[model samples]
Target: MPTSHCAYDTRLLVITLILLRGARAYTWSFKEAPSQCGQSTVAVAGNDGTPPFHILIAPFGPSPLPNGIETRQILDIPFTGNQSEVQFQLTYPTGSQFIAVVSDASGFASGGTGVATMVTNSTDNSCFDATSTVQFDFVFNIFPTVAQVVQCQNLRISTPNFLGIIPGGQSFVIPEGTITTDASTGTGFSYQANLRAGTTFLLMGGDVRGNGTGGSVTYIVALGNNDGSCLSNNSPSSTPGSPAGATSSSSSPSSTSGSSAGGSVPTET
Candidate 1:
């Protein structure tokens, strides 16, 4: 009887271990079939002289329809030292909204840090109207060294720009009057810019100084026009950039006058 009872207890222990491991694993799913979704290969520069790293993205939200069902999705973007550039694409159901949790997968595990930046442009003239606005929401897991956003005429060429600092959890917006914070949190905030038709902007967040402990950040980018109707087709392409305090030798983009404060353009890594 003693031998039989011991065997039963051992089996129960194994089953409990398996269940605990499965709980930590996260899966990705969507309410409707995604029209476009795929991964790309790219190179990510390391922070403080480390090797290239990878980013893990987990997207979750409800369908745009009234009383829509909620869903989730996951993607892992790998960056190597040999590759120069790559493209990633995802198209959500029309009118639907989602938020993505982005993290430095490899860097966080290895105790390294890096920059996270997403570059997006609107070339479709029809998508904009008199009320169009570009919105950005950033949720910081830990306060990063620096977080800001910039609007440019063209990302490839230097031009006049608009820069705004993202004050995590602050009641006020930076650079005084360029934009306004729509929402505030103890560790995050949201803001919007009334940009003209056909605009290119960069959303930047992450600890480039290797000062932050391993923590994930949430990012949401949306375009709304026609009186608050969400635009679903304008997904931005993300690419890592250089560390703080590094100057680019390239010529500065020409000055273009804007109502917001002006600053030198940041060099992309």
Candidate 2:
């Protein structure tokens, strides 16, 4: 019954951020594939202060698996347009391999404009100045043993750090097409966000696990201008004065992170 829980909701542990040079991306995720999958090429335009840009995510069918371990997949696809940052590691798995769909080809998305793909699968990609929308699909491959894929998502990568999605303190390298995990190599996930201005706006997150279940999601926002830097200018004005922001001031942990396994991520609301 809750809209979103602010504490320990694993589905909200990872965040994927995308920023474009002239537009904003309209991001949407799916757990059980869209009502229509890999069928439509129609792209809807998104607004990001700059001009309006439309884009389409080409469909990439269900993944091919290896074990009967109930395949589990986690994708960190990115979409972009104007200068917008999407919080990924804060909403999905860590070390998770993501497919880069950067292209300038005439696709349905981008309103006939063009998309360029750029993903070295690098770290704290600040120069992610490249504009393109990435569609990452994950297949949960943990069957015969468990049904739940993720325990949490969106863990606040406020500071790009080293680490990937960790379940029960375990880590896994997430990529686009394949869902994989290493019980021995503990997963590592860490992130740092400049917010350009840090917390000045509302940020929401969600986690998708291997079992084909949409984990859970939560949203947080900056309340006030805590510093005097143009970096802190990105925050929305309506936020509370007590929230966190200002490129000059570092953010203190104010929220909780969690995930779901046996059942849905406990509503953090």
Candidate 3:
């Protein structure tokens, strides 16, 4: 009886240790903007073992306007993590409609890696009447030691029209040696380009089909060396590029309008 009890105690101790290890390995925190239309800044520690951060954004409340012309919310999420992959899993309530507006005419700068996965419910009511009026601009300043390679991948977009806002748009300036691949099976888009040190890449476009909600979109932008190792890694070879910043542009789309929520927008040259 004594031997059996000793063995049971040992097993219990092992299990407790495992649980504690898991708790330490993964740690996350929650934050919200003062209002739905405000900007939110998420700061992540570099080389931390924490999993991808999750952001829960509430849906827009009932609009006071009878026509619902100004019934929209603007959210600008700027991530600041050095030598770390800035990743976020965003969740929105049903009937929530929003668009990725171009806040800066120039574009946001990247610290070599930026990734976001957004999940929301679909709604017929969009912020815009037509896709032509909607535009998205993503400009990244890539600073690398060697010939750095930047790859942008559109893993999944729920609405086919949203693909127009991706890199393949007309305003996009593809640098030399850039290889663009259109997915043969689905409505996916991807591009790989080699950028010299201290050069900027511009990706801007408008979709003819209006942007609606109800599904999800997964987009990934990563910078790495020729050997294919992510520059976001915390190794000696990992060249920590400059941090990316997103600023609001003066030009606003006439189709959609909203007031800023007073969140500080990070700015990088």
Best by TM-score: 1
Cα RMSD to the true fold for all candidates:
21.3, 18.7, 19.1
Cα misplacement distance, residue 131 of candidate 3 (Å) = 26
Give residue 222's lDDT in candidate 3 (0 to 100). Answer: 41
lDDT comparison, 2 vs 3, better candidate? 3
Residue-level lDDT tens digits of model 2 in 1-269: 11222342333322122322223344322111111111112222244223222222211111111221112222223435532332222211111111112212232122211111111112332321223222223211222112111222112221111112211111112222222234532232322222322211111122332211322111222223443342343322222332211111011122222222111122221
Model 3 per-residue lDDT tens digits across residues 7-60: 223222210101111122222221221112222233333343433232222122
Least lDDT summed over 10 consecutive residues: which range in candidate 3? Answer: 13-22
- Once fitted onto the true fold, the runs of candidate 1 whose alpha carbons sit more than 4 angstroms away are 1-49, 65-67, 80-86, 89-91, 94-106, 109-269
TM-score of 3: 0.21
TM-score of each: 0.23, 0.21, 0.21
lDDT for each of the candidates? 0.24, 0.22, 0.24
TM-score of 1: 0.23
